[model samples]
Target: MMDRPVGVIGAGRVGTALGLALVRAGYELVGVNARSEASRQRAADVLPGTPLRDVPTLAKSAGILLLSVTDDAIGSVAAELADGGLLQPGQIVLHVSGACGLAVLAPATEAGAVPLAVHPAMTFPGLPTDADNLAGLAYAVTTRPHDRPLAEELVRDVGGVPVWIADEDRTLYHAALVLGANNLITLLAAAMEALMAAGVPDPGFVLAPLVRASMENALRHGDQALTGPVRRADVGTIEAHLRALRDRAPHLLPAYLDFGLNTARRSRRAALNEAGRLDEVIALLEARSAEARDDIDR
Candidate 1:
């Protein structure tokens, strides 16, 4: 499979990044497909003179077809290609969806194509780091036992660290990735905007290092990594936060509260402002969440 050319059915970010990188990694870009005229145009812009082919055509053209479409579209896209009678025996099909398991490639398998899922655990901000981001980054791989070696080889070929997961639990595994990466971004956006509103000059300068250090600490220590008001259970500060957020950014208030409450519940503490006063912070957060739950049920 490493020696064979590849096909990319969806020329979006992941598709394009992987396709271009594979080309650099010494794999031929045999055939490609992208849904919209806009997307096709975009692909053409990137790989000049590459003709647009249907999904099935893309499948037939390469031994390994990268099903880089969105999660919801993977199954149908695979099915359409399989129905076109394009899959040959011993061929391989793969997808980059974090949550989708081998089942997303069921159609390909039915058509005698081996299915593999290669989900990278890094965010796809843009193309600047696409080729290099997967290098040394953890990638979750789910597939049949027969396909494990091939999948691992492919992961390494593309400069990624491969890890295994069971077929049934892929969805939950994907959820955890979302909670960490996506939620972190959403939380940071809120904090950054808040800093700007509070008239903190050079908000990024003020927040990036602090946030990075906090993340570094948290990753190193797990729940014990918690700090600040929530960890200390500062009821007064929490109350003030509720009032101010409700007044200024109501939409973000719920998200902040929900995450805060969850963090508080996990930390389990209350009533102090000093460093390492997490006991006080945790208590207030837990208490605040409990009060919210009580009101909700009423």
Candidate 2:
């Protein structure tokens, strides 16, 4: 079963990279079904000389079908394959959507295909280096009870560890990843822009060590790694910073207050002695919120 030819239904970043990696792992590459010219070109580059065929053709020629389409398109594509009578018994069908589960492949299953979800828990730039990026990363796998072992094996073959996730937990699991990966990118961009606004010549150079060390510490000690005014409950220092933000960078004030409030709450839960200080900080935040409301009303 592991030696069977695998066909990719989409040719975007995940599809191309995974196809290339599977080829490298000794799995037979069964060509691809790309929807667009760009996708066809990508497949040609990654799995060069692999034949380009239609969805049903690709499904017929391969023992495994990987649906690497967009989230919304996944269900439709499954339905299309099922309608075309392409999914054969004992064949495997998987998608790389973190938020989706085996349910999206109901169409495929009804056609006798074994449904599975195999999401790589990492960002894909769709470049040639994507295969290297896959090494040592985790894969979120959602599948039927009996299919778990095969799913884990497939992930291992792709150079990733499989983390079994319940179908119902897929939403929460994907949300956590987005908050950590996507939102972290947004936060970093904001920090870099704010530093540049403050006359820093190179924000990346200035932030590199500080950001890296903080990340390392947080990974090691969790909330205990927290520092600065929020951790110490220094009301005056926080107030001063809030004032500076309002004057010099008003756009950043809302985010600052929101993070400060969340930090204060976390600190109270982590340390009993800090409750009083945290209460004071919360009061200050509430006051500021009231002032903002009043200003908006005016």
Candidate 3:
């Protein structure tokens, strides 16, 4: 596939970054197709001198097509490209959607394109260094046994290590990634806002070291690194937290109760035994949740 020309079907952040990375890795970028003019300009910026054409034009010109559109659009895009009758046998077509598999590319496969799924386990911001960020990253590669070598080679060409993910587990694997990366961002933003609401002037600066250390420890020690009120089963402290959030940040109460209860549930057996009242914490959370629901119903 590297010997033949490459094209991008979505000029979003991931598409632009992957296109540039492949270009830097010596892949011949023939053309790119994006849904919008702004995305076409982004593609032009990433792959200078490359033409920005329609999907069919790109399909006709390139042997390896990278579909980096949103997950929902991938199937439709594949169907449209296949219906155009531009794909040829032996052509390698891949999508960079973590939540989807080669099934989304069935139309292209029916048109004789060899379908593959390659999802980089990293974020892209449509910048030049976004391509550089691909180095040393892990890519979830899903493909048929005969196409494994092709997938691995493409991953390596862009300085990534390929990890085989079974098609049946793709959605679960992607959900785990979302929980770890995307959900962490949401949690951290909530923490920052909560801190600001509590009068912390620079929440991020104050929280940075603690968050980093906690994450590193959690990664290194698993659940053994659990700490704080939930792990300690400090019912009084947790009750106080619920009260404060209810009075000042009611919008955050549901997430707090849910995550706190989950954390309490996952606390080490030894810690719960030591506290001897973990049930109290669970009860407090459950009662508060029911009360909140009752209030909403009222």
**TM-score winner:** 3
Each model's lDDT comes to 0.78, 0.86, 0.86
lDDT of 2 by residue, 10-127 (tens): 9878878877888888899877889888888888777788888888788888888988789899999999999998888979998989999888899999999999998888898767
Candidate 3's clash total is 0
Clashing pairs for model 2 are: none
lDDT of 1 by residue, 1-298 (tens): 5687798888766767777767767788887788787678757766656677876567667878888788899999889878888889888888988889988788889989889898888787545356666678888999889889898888888787799989998999999988898988888888888777778877889988899999999799888777766766677888899777767765566676788867766665322234345555555556655765675679
TM-score of 2: 0.94
Q: 107, model 1: CA deviation in Å? A: 1.8
Q: What is the lDDT of residue 15 in candidate 2?
A: 70
Say which prediction, candidate 1 or candidate 2, comes out ahead on lDDT: 2
Off by over 4 Å in 2: 293-298
Report the Cα lDDT for candidate 2.
Answer: 0.86
| CA displacement after TM-score superposition, residue 106 of candidate 1 (Å) | 1.2
Least well predicted 10-residue stretch by lDDT in candidate 2: 288-297
Alpha-carbon TM-score of each model against the true structure: 0.86, 0.94, 0.94
